[model samples]
Target: MSSDVAGIYARESPYLDRYVQVGIAQGRVISLSFPETPDEGAESEHDMLDRIESYLDGVEESFDDVQVALTVPTDQRQVLEAVREIPYGQDSSVAQIARVTPGLDDENDDDLRAIREALTENPAPILIPDHRIRDGPGSTPPAVVDKLRSIEGL
Candidate 1:
């Protein structure tokens, strides 16, 4: 059976957009993209939710879970909290690292927040290709390609 996975993001960064794409057949991420331009004018939260829902509808079936990777650019602490409150998974791989690392004076929960924030906050474009189905010479960083291919559990 096909599965569904959605990644919803709200970013003000000029380099990113709100669109996301993922692999549903095996619970793996394929790629993510954001519109180059932010939606202008006043938009209600419900309107934003509807937009996100439309993006997720591309999947073949109802997703087992919905995940959001939103980014807030201002003192929108309330928005950040709201994003966290959504019934979905928040990427915390970086956060977990910050939690376990011994204090060396340069890292903390705030640092983790920064990293996670960058995922959605900075508006950087991220494209995750389907490694199993696509390949090209010199298309990806050598180190990254090596690391991904070496993973035993990919």
Candidate 2:
């Protein structure tokens, strides 16, 4: 995984005890990681990083235009696409996402668990915005989700 990655940059956000690390590849975001403690370094000068920090600061910014590269299986990718469709300042249940997901079998052996699994493994938390998904933890840390919800006034 490290070999395939081109570069990673870190930036601090007062919103949490962690700094956001944005992974880049071919000029697009490929991964996003939030660590408990930020490393000593310059904040990223990347446009996407700037946009996210601005949005967290209550700026009128929408990440909907930012592109992400999901290096996952087809079914998980489909689930992620549905997760991305969740509008800003809104929420949806996992069942709702599964209903819109074509590759998902919402009835077979209780497909909700599969859907939950996919969202839990999402690499791009804010970019994919898994926190928008309702009814449970939905991938990211619970505290982070709560913070995001508060940030969006949801």
lDDT of each: 0.31, 0.77
- Model 1: lDDT equals 0.31
lDDT of 2 by residue, 26-70 (tens): 767787878776555634666777778887887755577777888
Predicted structure with the largest lDDT when compared to the true one: 2
The number of clashing residue pairs in each candidate reads 2, 0
lDDT of 1 by residue, 66-119 (tens): 332334444333323322332222222443333433441125656545434433
The weakest ten consecutive residues by lDDT in model 2 span: 1-10
Model 1, position 58, has a per-residue lDDT of 29
Candidate 2: Cα lDDT at 149: 82
> Deviation in angstroms for 4 in model 2?
15
Q: What TM-score, computed on C-alpha atoms, does each candidate reach?
A: 0.22, 0.86
Q: Which clashing pairs does model 1 show?
A: 17-34, 17-35
